[model samples]
Target: MRRVLTALLLTSLLPLIAQAQSYSHTPPGHTGLGGMIGNPSGLSLKVYGTDPASFTAYDFLLAYDLDRFFFFSLHGLYERPLPDSPLNYFLGPGALLGVREGSSHANEMVLGLSANLGINFFTERFEVFLQVTPRLHLIPETEGDIGGGIGLRYYFGSQ
Candidate 1:
């Protein structure tokens, strides 16, 4: 009787185990649209990373800065996830472009190099993330700044 009951229980659990094995990670070929509020706060978008080709993901941010000027950044990130966890961390190189609030001889348009570092938590079709950006101003001036923000994204499409 015990052996028969054990066999039946195991058989019944097989489908659940199969479903768990078929789980997909966040993003990963999916696109996420979201917003962030920080130093330069506005729109955010991401082309989540894929596997077997490259571990790189593309992220974009378009926002207005504390100076009331429009700012945009793009990062090509290398992402990794914690073992058996829903948390992911990414780091990568980025480019920054911004327009000055007013026309000036110096840096009417600013260009720079920035680094993107962040952690993400995912649920069903949503992701919550936090990032810190360290930047180097290379055009119009030589300066450095650090910025960070927290954001939520909703992923769509097949992953």
Candidate 2:
């Protein structure tokens, strides 16, 4: 079931991810601030290892949902542009910590690992991306989940 859903999602995004041409541009800035709306959705912060033409970055996300549970995740990502276009793809491993309400009015700490796969289309001042993440919960119990979303980010200071 999970695999089917993931395949369906990637299929839907493939058309969008593949359309880019005629440009040779590097990523524009050192940091980006954005919001993602998805299975775990909220504020997103992206910071690069190098200011101008970074090939690596860190992604931080904080979200609240599932009847008010809080979630946090951090990803160390390797990002690279596609030779002559502003479109980039990234993949990485990440860790997640979440607080959720359990049965009997108790709260549980959820720990998980996630694999991120995504593509970004960069303009002069902003980036639009589509991402898919597969997550494995290892604490409280073992479970699996599929997560992703379409997001937009605005660069800071310089373009």
Each candidate's lDDT (Cα)? 0.76, 0.75
lDDT for model 1, on a 0 to 1 scale?
0.76
lDDT per residue for candidate 2 within 1-159, as digits (tens), equals 544754676577566556634123334347889987666678888887765354488888887744556889989888877776667788899999998888777999999999888988766656677788898989989998887876777778764
| Local lDDT at 145 for model 2 | 80
lDDT (Cα, tens digit) per residue for candidate 1, span 1-159: 533653575466445444442222564678989987666678999886767477567899998867656779999988777677656788999999997665553446789999999877666666667789998978778989888777777888865
TM-score of 1: 0.76
- Indicate the worst ten consecutive residues by lDDT in candidate 1: 16-25
* Model 2 worst lDDT window (10 residues): 20-29
Number of clashes recorded per candidate: 0, 0
List where candidate 1 sits over 4 angstroms from the true fold: 1-24, 102-107
Compute the lDDT of residue 44 as modeled in candidate 2: 86
Off-target runs (Cα >4 Å) in candidate 2 are: 1-29, 51-55, 65-68, 83-85
